[model samples]
Target: MGELFQEAILVSILAATVRIMTPLLFAAIGELVTQRAGIWNMGVEGTMLMGAFVAYIVVTAADSLVGAVLAALLAGALMGLLVAFMTVTLRVDHFVTGLGLNLLASGLTLFWFRSYIAGRPQPTFDGFENVALPGLSDIPYLGEILFTQRGLTYFAVLAVPLVWYFLYRTKYGLEVRCLGENPKALDVKGVNVAARQYCAVVFGSVMTGLGGGFLMLGFSDRFLAEVTAGRGWLAIVAIIAGNWMPKGVLLAVLVFAFLEALATHVQVIGVAVPHQVFLALPYLASILLMMGFKVRAGQPAALGVPYRRA
Candidate 1:
């Protein structure tokens, strides 16, 4: 009985870790692609928050999961478009543009949320449920840990390899990488540098939006202000700590997710330590991870530098 109970706890923790990883993975990997194309978007937190907010509204008002997802995507795309315009066209500092977006999103979402629920009970919806894959979900321990998960969780896991292939194997991928290294070279070859950066930024924001939607629909029944709770910041940290590689990002995300999962479970298991300590573990780990990782070899040389034609 004792052995079985311990095993169950282990499985539960691992499963939670995988689930928690979904949102962070989406945001981190997406940002990895954006950074590789020379744009350092700092508005991930706002983009994600907007996605989550739009999703919650659509889901509750229309009661349509599909609509909610689409709304989140649209919201993200809009944010991306603004980022591209400011950074690529207006030549605003990338950091400034991103931070401005974050502030706008924060203030805008809070006001909208307040108006949304005014004189009404907070809206709620049935979030995603686990989908247990047949044959795979039946396997002993691994099945419980890996096979039974929200559908988006599976997709998030697949995105890592898919993104890796896109970055390392495709022709366009090489051009995108070149944008980070030498946009002038691409321009000499007649490739449009600003256009490529626009596409990259939009793509990253779209994915981050999807991640935000997943974070909301998969984990919570209703929306709250700042619902992302700094996961966006953590995603940025993961990109830096992972050396901007997909595999490294995956490992980094797993560690952070595991810490978060441990925190969630610690409350259930009734550990004597303050719950706040467990809650702080992932952020604390982020600081340690950043301090420990010194490698910047994979970083794009021209990243965050506004492109100009000679």
Candidate 2:
């Protein structure tokens, strides 16, 4: 235990934890908004994969990080538009729509990757670099842990409070929340429920895309099939575990990220356990946490139910 707390190892783990949490934070916040609007978007994994694929392709071709990221955002929003059309406008089953999108994304990304890089060496590119805060970064352990990170990491952390305020303090947010609870009430009051839902789903998907883009641009040097690696699903879990609140979701993300960081370090620290066990730690923790904390009470009343005009 003492060895585990050594300054170097501890700092490494903490920094890794923050980096790991960034993507989840983005996706979870987006999903939180979508769910709050009464749309159960199960296609987040697919959306993220598509984003990663788009970002990678754009970055490789255009050699511009900004362009790649923008492409990724557009891809995510387009996917969200499809989801909204199917679920909101056409009244398709939300889960089925989401599952179908996931399949579509998986197949499409693989197809694109094969076609683009066929009979050639896999391409690689430099990702985002860590930026240390001025005076704050010079502080001791806390400074290294919090003040030194990729720009996206800082954005994700700051988004938590911003999202909380938006959800609890703004009119648009109140309308969004009402969409999940009593959409009919909003309709009665002349609010466009479907329009609001469309915005929420699109907004959530854009963030999810950004999360995927960050995964590729900030963490990995090259693109691979299914590069999202189930982070999208974990984001959904974080939302559920957090009880649909931004702060709660952030806490859940941190716990999961910590487990992941610990898993990586355990191998380095010469732990005698099977490597696979450490690899499974984060996932196992997720299952246990979900089992222990049931969030039915906090879930939106009309969640997963499509709104119909009376």
Put down candidate 1 lDDT per residue, 1-310, tens digits, no spaces. Answer: 2332597898999999999999999899998899999999999999999999999999999999999989989999999999999999998999999999999999999999999999989989998889999999999999999999999899999999999999999999999899998999999999989999999999999989998999999999999999999998899999999998999999999999999998888888887789999999999999999889877888899999999997
Regions more than 4 Å wrong, model 2: none
Q: Report the poorest 10 consecutive residues by lDDT, candidate 2.
A: 289-298
lDDT of 1: 0.93
Residue 245 of model 2 has an lDDT of 86
Q: Estimate each model's TM-score.
A: 0.97, 0.97
Give the least accurate 10-residue stretch of model 1, judged by summed lDDT: 1-10
Q: What value does the lDDT take at residue 221 in candidate 2?
A: 88
What's the true lDDT of residue 168 in model 2? 92
RMSD of 2: 1.2
